[model samples]
Target: MKAPAISLLAGLLFGAGLAVSGMADPARVRAFLDLFGAWDPMLAFVMAGALMPMTIAWLVQQRMPRPIACEAFDLPGTGLLDAKLLLGAILFGIGWGIGGLCPGPALADLAIAPSEAGIFVVAMLAGMTAHRITRG
Candidate 1:
């Protein structure tokens, strides 16, 4: 119960931050990616802001035995990058560049821009499903 509530709160905060930072806007994100064209640097500030807290959290996690709501610390394995990892990253980058919506921003835009966000989310889920099917 506590863990779920904390997760919900964290998700809500992340969504709110995405919205407030203009990341939920596909146009803004697209603009940010346009380096040779009309590039916007606001996204850099937002990324920096997010990175600070995340870095601190990671540092704190290294010192803590376990999270407040969890019995164990389940960190991702620090393994060498493989072909699958490279392919997944390439796919993710292509999707982000073309759609101007990554998972977080796309999910955040769901309430505000349902039509566009819905399409992206559906496609993303389909891609995930395809990956699972292919991996298995």
Candidate 2:
């Protein structure tokens, strides 16, 4: 119960940050990726801002036995590079580049622009399903 509530609160804060940072806007993200064209550096700033807190959290996690809301940290164990990881990363990059809407931003955009965001979210879900089916 506590873990779920904490997760929900964290998600809400993340979504709010995305919205406030203009990261939920596909055009803004697209512009950031357009290095040779009308490039925008706002995303870099947002990334830096996000990185700071995450870095601190990771450092804190190292000193703590477990999270306050959970028995374990639930962090990923693997740091190994593999074909599957590479392929998934490539696919994710392709999708992000083409649509300018990654999962977080796309999910956040759903409330502001349902039609566009819905299409992206549905496609993303389909990709996730395909990956799961193929993995097994």
Candidate 3:
């Protein structure tokens, strides 16, 4: 199939899987993340289920023939857990904890309330654009 068709199919599958797995539910995620409160571990199990296939695929990729470009995998060069990385992670965690909705969940929430999700998504895209511009 063509690249656009393949990409669209992959996105559809991913969205459907997220919907089926309840990852789109902020309340469910909030409950799962509330370890100190009435802690629910179901999301961990769900994440494990989701990751297993991806993990297997990644392992398989390690043994595959290199692409025609004739270069080794261009993985991230920096392995250091630097201060910037740590700070970014902390900010992300805080946002998730406060909102009970990460990007995917927020996007999925669009199905129920388009205006809110549309605003959030637009703001997110704007932030990304600004970051790229500033960094570049």
Question: Which scores greater on lDDT, model 1 or model 3?
Answer: 1
How does model 2 score by TM-score? 0.94
Q: Top model by TM-score, which number? A: 1
- Please, what are the lDDT tens digits per residue for candidate 1 over residues 2-104? 9999999999999998999998888988899999999999999998888888999999999998889999988788999999889889988888889999999
How far residue 133's Cα lies from its native spot in candidate 3, in Å, is: 4.4
Please, what is the whole-model Cα lDDT of each candidate in the order they appear?
Answer: 0.92, 0.92, 0.75
TM-score of each: 0.95, 0.94, 0.79
Note each model's CA RMSD in angstroms: 1.0, 1.2, 3.1
lDDT of 3 by residue, 43-106 (tens): 8888899788999977987887763243555556668898868977887787677666678767
Model 2 residue 15 lDDT score: 93
- Winner on TM-score between 1 and 2 is 1
1-136 per-residue lDDT for model 2 (tens digits): 9889998999999899999999999999999999999999999999988888899988998999878987787777868998888988999988998999999999999989999999999999999898789885
Off by over 4 Å in 2: none
TM-score sort, best first: 1, 2, 3
Off by over 4 Å in 3: 66-78
Candidate that beats the other on TM-score, 2 or 3, i.e. the better one: 2
